[model samples]
Target chain A: MATTAGERESSLWVILLTFAVAMLFSVVSLPEFIPWQLGYLRPQWVELVLIYWIMALPHRVGIFSAWVLGLFVDVLTGSLLGQHGVAFIIVAYIASSLYQRLRMFAVWQQSLIIFVTIGISQLVNFWVENFVGLSQWDMRFLLSALVSAMLWPWVFLVLRHLRRLFNVS
Target chain B: MIGLTLLSIALMVVDHLSDLLDEVRSGLTVVVTPVYIVADYPNRAADLAQQMFTSRDGLQEQVISLEEQLLLMKVKTEKMSALTAENNRLRDLLGSAAKLQDNVLVAELVGVDPDPNKHEVVIDKGTQHDVFVGQPVLDAEGLMGQVIEVSPLTSRVLLISDQSHSVPVQVVRSNLRLIAQGTGVTRQLDLMHVQGTADIKQGDLLVSSGLGNRFPVGYPVGIVTQFKHNPSEPFAKATANPSAMLDRSRYVLLVFTEASLREPVIGAEG
Candidate 1:
């Protein structure tokens, strides 16, 4: 599965494009595009994208890049400046370290792992937000993690299709 | 990973403790505003298409209704000027200055904060239009919120319904002063520190008291929607629905009040 020099070069652009679209999806108010109630169940599109890239191409996208992108999300959402950054760095570290095993799992098993990773990320966000007195504790905060896990297979398939189409490493 | 974690914590601490990062955040907002505009494109396009496809007869009917409404408002305003002049004369007799008229700029909401836990919105007005942090915002119905961050072409408003936001308000009937805190619910605000025997009741009107000098006095804040009292508890809990349409308003007014203009500069130490 070794990638040639040309494939490696092209993958960078594809990665950036995918990440950009994911970021757009993460910040856009889906409620306006869809039904209002469904906004509460909107999946963590950026985290799903990050997880896919880290699993598919661990060497190219790692912890540091994830942290930077998380900062972008924080600024975009008007949350605490570093709230997403910390959670994302942890998720990226775990995903990259386990990338070899993660790629070999069945889609359902992979989705199970996504449930754990995104749950951890959401928990970290809840902790930081509550610590700063920005948000209250609620059972509903965990809803997004579950929703992200449910969407994992579709996101994985689409990202995989894009990677193969672009011959991305 | 450890370095990044520590750096992020440091940023959180700095952002929470001081206004130092506000400028940096505002500068970054310039870069992100394009994304918001693009994200908002679909709604704007839909609105434009609706307008274009509207029937001419429907437009004419709307114009006639608007004209009649304008004439009625003009007549009311004529009476209001006489009342205002008399009020000013009475205030002068009491050795007080005349009430300052506020300058206002209309801005449209361009985007909403996607985080359901937080309440904030981006307005189209910014520093280019003299918008600044701490400016009070209002919808046509009532007081809404204040500007927290300003970029070149846009600004972020911290809605009064945000969990961290609070405003000083007085009951219109009893003149009882209480602080209204956001419950992170778009439709309601919680009144803090009210006694079980307080005069608050359902249907009471709450208006800004101007105690902190941040919000102007006598503007409608909310109306008491629910009241709960427990004799054993030291304080009674009450909730009010905000007068402004926090969830649906498309346009807001940025009020340029004298107090905000005269606010003291934050020292470097802060």
Candidate 2:
């Protein structure tokens, strides 16, 4: 059966809204807040939003979109050109491919998986960076992934409303 | 599927063409700057309100004391100028050109990266004001970071406290050179590749060794806070607290050198 017109419209809205949120999230804060900063609690708002959209509407947010988003992030964050694009494409594919299994898990369980996905993404980022002859490792990578995972629930709730507003299923 | 494959291949090629893409990157920076400004308006208003509501007496006292300190520092600096001139003269005689970076344009700190793993700051300066990628940023006390992304009227800086940030620095005490990398936590920096027997200690000041040529020489970067020599390993792990107040800087300076714009990254003492 064909998807409902409302669902299709909502899907487009969700993807665009998510992209805006990711862009804003990426540029909004300098990592200077919070005292005694734990490395695990870093916010991966973009990845979180991307995962949500990819799972919610795989048809709209696909490999090409993820790659473009990652490219923008690369420019925004000043990483090597393809560094974020590669990581994002990998994470987007992983999250989307496993969406069926992931959707069935409890919220907490899903957060754990999200954490792992982002953690793996960071590792991939580190690996590619090193391969490009820019190798430097610090504990913050794991910490940021963990923290971003922890924040997934709240992010999901917020983005879900945006999805509703945009009429995305 | 073939179309997608072709698109991916095209993107991969464009991604590898870093040098050729600088113009496009710079152009994109110009295009999205307005978005950042609109998003940052609320935060700026809140900060302004907070500053306006601060206790009058507190603000007055701060200004008075700061002026006094500045006067004292000015007197001391005057005394050191002649000595500096003599040092420069000697260096000039030795055929070493004195490399001086221009003073930076002060930029407002609009936002911090929401992610703690990536220590970055968005500043209100961009290509519109001639700020370019790789411009050195400085907080009141010392080195902060470099501009990594330039939107038309805004730019993002990667702070020295980010894991991705690294710089070549020399221990003020021993002049031992090492690469200092960010630990992704505010105020913490780690020096890589120091043997256990190295003559570095806690409280040692690390200055930009000027060897990297990316950063101007003689700026304070950080102070060694922890030094551990593991008997099991040949290398010692050292951490420094960045002198730049990354957490509190409301205003920062972005130093741009027109001459160094296209210059290669200089490798300094390792």
Candidate 3:
């Protein structure tokens, strides 16, 4: 059901809050003792959170929103500008398109899609960075996709809980 | 989606190849500063916990050890002062530029770069504290990196171990000049293009030669940890361990050389 105007406005704030938290998590590094080894083990928090928001409220979040969030990530990570925007745009388009079928899939099945999509986005990033000769030439970047896929179940559940608790559409 | 991707590519090209987006990045940093502050809480909490949980006797022992170290350092400085004066006289006789004493500002590590591949860290000092891009950062040990981007309240330092970073170095023992390049590993730097007959050896100290004017002259940069001269290859290979604790030190010092200070103060934070 379409919500009241006030509720909708409140949901937008809730949505933005979730995005902010995701950005915070995305930039925070692990302890010094734990070596991430080229971020092969780090999960993509922004992409995961964006996926949740788009799947839950596709009408509100779109490719434009993802592009904007990607720019935010670029600044946060100190990468070349718009590095993440291209990947987010591509992933957001695919995600928004299949969000319907995604809602019906089991968590594990959805995670398979998560693996594929994150892998694709990572490739896009790899390509862009490679163009500037910034990325190391290795297949190991896919390890992050594996880690993101494994974390998808928990991320989906927690974000869903937050959306419901905030009474977001 | 295609149109947006094209637009993103245009932005990336501009950013990677030019300084056009530097202002944009710094302006957008206002949005990131608060997030970084919140993200840094865990590190702050861990440090706080260490202070809180340390027994009083433990702290006293640390203080005693520090005092002893300070006394030892003072003795060394007394000799160093005389040596520095003599060296300055020698340089003046040779009609060379005398070394300028550097001004250093203490900065706290606010955040580490989330990307593990890019060895960069964020420091609390920014334009607000006269920290500028290309300023050298040092840990208590030795050279760490240079500031590459400055926000209003924070700046980012690209560490010496970043894959894209390199510094001009000299062997203190042999006076051999070399280019120490980052090999994308923590605390490890490679001396590139070593001639087959170079005199590099393990345990030799590498100091900043300051040829490129990027880092301060005479700062400890690295130590030759491994060396090999291959007969077949055109060049030999040597590796060094950076003097700075590349992966550990949370407190870093930003150095203001005479060159960096010569620029006009564009705005506030003088």
Instruction: Give the C-alpha miss distance for residue B140 in model 3, angstroms.
Output: 1.4
How large is the interface RMSD of candidate 1? 1.7
Ranking by lDDT: 3, 1, 2
Per-residue lDDT of model 2, residues A1-169, tens digit only? 5879877876776577667766776566433344635434547778998898887778778777888777777666656566677778878888888988887888898899998999998998887666555545666678778888888888888877877676665
TM-score, second chain, candidate 3: 0.93
The DockQ score of candidate 2 comes to: 0.26
Show the lowest summed lDDT stretch of 10 residues, model 1 chain B: B261-270
Best of the two (1, 2) by TM-score: 1
Q: What's the number of clashes in each of the models?
A: 0, 16, 0
For all candidates in order, the CA lDDT equals 0.85, 0.75, 0.88
Ten-residue stretch with the least lDDT total in model 3 chain A: A31-40
| Positional deviation of residue B224's Cα in model 2 after best superposition, in angstroms | 4.1
**What would the per-residue lDDT of candidate 2 be over residues B1-270, giving only the tens digit for each residue?**
235445544554565555666667667656556556666766777778889998989899989999999999888777766667777688888987663435457889876664445677788877777777788888879999888777677788988887778988999999999899997667689899988999999999999886766887778899999999989987899999999998888899776553465432332111
